[model samples]
Structure formats: structure tokens, C-alpha cells
Target: MRTRITTIAATVMLTAAAIAHAGNVGISAGDYYSPTLATTLTAQGNSVHAVGWYNDNVLSTYDVYIQDGSSFADAAALDRFVYHGGTLIQLPWSFTNIAYTADTTVFSRRRRGTLEQLNPGIDVIAPDDWLLAGVTLPEAGTQTIGREIGNRFADGATPVLEWEDGTALLGYRRYGAGLVVGFDVHLVTADASPLSADWSNRIIGNAISPVPELSTWAMLATGATMLLLRRRRPD
Candidate 1:
């Protein structure tokens, strides 16, 4: 009875996997903006990883934001908060205060050569504590991307912004598997137009393939043993 149950379960799982792989689903969160945007992951089977990218330029200083709900209605819902140097901070769901200053010394030290010279004439607003360049899975499931702001900087800088024809990589892990999503916004200059573009749609079609599940190997071994036993029986 136990063997029969296991066989039935495995068969069901295989059928589900076949159906999931046969029809792929994709999601996109049009452009980069403040507040959290929520979307679904399709073609990921029972378990799947998700990755995404944004133009670093969209963030004035260094901050990140995520989607709050399945739609754009609850865009202001606060999720996870991060600092310019990649430090995680805490924010209340209704919190809205976003003010900060750059560490001139650290900023200057990090900014050498062209970056230092390019600092002038550009507006660099320190991102709120609740922001991130990208998000990950597992962690993101509980957390969210906060608000995002794109700023204009001089060209030829080492780290470019998201709205400047750049790319940001965001990935997530699901069910011991990995999923990666990339956003490529080809904007010639720094502007909000790119933020309005449906970059997320482009991302859904570009999901990373999943790896083989461990159960597959176990099933293969079982099949091999059954074949050997049948051969030895020799009718």
C-alpha cells in the first residue's frame, strides 16, 4: 500500500511538472518607481526562484523599494528598508519620513577620479533608509522593496544609475531552486520616461531555467533497480 501511494504521488508530481513546463507564465512590474509593486510568478512549477533587475540610476542615492500588493493600488505600502551602503533598516508600514545626508568623507573617499569631478552639478539626494538596489527570494517573501527615486548624474561614472541605460539584477530562491530576472532599460539619458516603461514585461520572458530536482535522481535509481531485477529473473 505504501509503495502504491508513493508511486501515485510521484506520477502526480510528474504530471504537474509536465503541465507547468508546457505552459510558461511571466510577470512584469512596469518601470521603476516608489512604493512596492506585487506580481505573480508563472511557469515556476510548484516551486521556483525569481530574480529581477533595475537601473541603478533610478535611485538618487542608494535605496530600494518593493511591490506591496498584487496590483499598483497599494503602492505606498512599506516593505523592506536599506541604506546607501547596503545596510538594512526598519520602517513602519505607515512610515513616510525620508530624509538623509551623505557621508561626505566616505562618499568622497569612494568617489575617485571622474566620479569625484562628476559629483558637482548633479543632484544626489540620499535615498531613504528603506530602499535597495535589488531583492532576493525567501527574504523577499517576508520583506518588500520600498520607495525608489531616480537621479541624474554625469556620464562615464563607475556605478551608473538605472535610468541611464543600465541594468540591475534581482534574484530569488524557491523550493531549493533558483530564479533570476533581469531588467534592461535602454534610455539614452536620465529621465522618468524610462521609469514608466514596462520593463517588467520584458523580464518575464527572460526567466532562468530550473535545475533537476533531487527526487528525479531517486526515481531514476528506482527504475534502474527494477530493470536489473527483471533481467535477472530471466523469465
Candidate 2:
């Protein structure tokens, strides 16, 4: 009986550990920008995957998905994944890469005076949101020049971050069972100084490696209670 209790405790501890570890961050195959991303996230202890193929069940397979490619397999698949509770971080021009064939949804776009591009300033609309941890945007709410990158969301999308002209730099939209956090591509700063480069890496890291939920704690507690009860049982 003592051995059985020890085994149960070990099993529960393992489950608790797995729950705390969280999901893997999927970086698109040809995204050229993900190497730094992987490095930053890994340093923070997140399992990052370079995704080569995305078919059925693909969206649900990952905890977070960054639209890093110039092309994605299916928009409907992505939509389903988000509403189903998957987190998404996107880059600029990702709209051009994805063919939203499932519906007539229109993604918006605008150029800031045709010259202010690349490395645009980011905003933090939801300060308390878990996805925003270790992230800040000083250029928010101001006309900041970027790497000429530009993309906007459809009419119904909620703005999490916006450009100087009020375009979405980062935004949130609830689809089915998930939430989508859209990001402009140029905002990705990686492999630079600790103060600046690859800030998004922490964003992805924090997303895939979140704190233990109540259910996770409950599971751990349940196991402990079981062991305690077993120890006190009249043998």
C-alpha cells in the first residue's frame, strides 16, 4: 500500500509538471524571422516548433500560432483554432499571404504617408492581458514610423494596439473558441540587446508557458489529499 501511494504521488506530480509546462509555440516554416524568436522563447523555457505543414487538426495542435509565412494553408482552419481557444500572433502582410476562402471577410490595410515604414511603434491596449507581459510600446498612440509594414483587420475586430493613424498594430478578435492577437510583422525585434531585440519572443514565451490554472492546482491537491487519506487509513 505504501508503494502504491508513492507511485500515485509520483504520477500526480508528473501530471502537475506537464500542466505547468504549457503548449508549444509554432513558428511558420519559411518565416526567416523565427530563429531569433525561437532563441528568445527557448531561453525563457518554451518549446518552439518550426512548422512545416499545417493540415486538419493543425491549428488545435499548437497553443500559439504566429502567422510567419507569406502563405498559410487555410483561413478557416485558423479561424476555428482561435475560437477554439488558440492564441495567435501575426506579422504584417500576413493578410496578403493568407487566402480567406471560407468567407468574404476583408482585412484592412493602410500606408502611413507611404514612407513611414518598418519597425513601427507598437501599442499596448490591454495592459492587464496575460499576452502582454514583458511587452511595452512607447510609440503607442503616436505617429511613429515603421519598416513600411502595414495591415489592418476587418470591421468587427477589436483593437489591442493601433498605429498613429489608428490602424491595428495589434488587435484582438474572438472567432470561435479562441482569441486572435494580430501583430504587424515589423514590430518583431529579436536577437538585439536585452532591452529591445526579440521582445515578441517573451510574448510568445509567456503565452505558451502560462502560470498553472486553478484546475492544475486542484489536480495537484487532489493527489495530495488522496495520499494523505491513504496514509491515515486503518490498515
Backbone clash numbers for all candidates listed: 30, 19
lDDT per model vs. reference? 0.25, 0.58
Q: lDDT tens string, model 2, 119-235?
A: 345555666665566665454423323332445666766665555544565555566665566655343223332212444555555556655555766777677767678778897
Candidate 2 lDDT: 0.58
* Cα-based TM-score, every candidate: 0.23, 0.62
Model 2: residues >4 Å from true position, as ranges? 1-21, 101-107, 110-124, 138-150, 187-198, 209-235
lDDT per residue, candidate 1, 1-235, as tens digits? 4465466556755764553341222112442322121222332231221213323333222222332112221211111112232211111111122221221100111111110111111111322101121211122122122221222222221221132112212222111121111121211113322222233322332222222355764675576556555656856
CA shift at 146, candidate 2, in angstroms? 5.4
Model 1 residue 159 lDDT score: 27
- Compared with the true structure, model 1 gives a TM-score of 0.23
Worst 10 residues of 1 by lDDT: 104-113
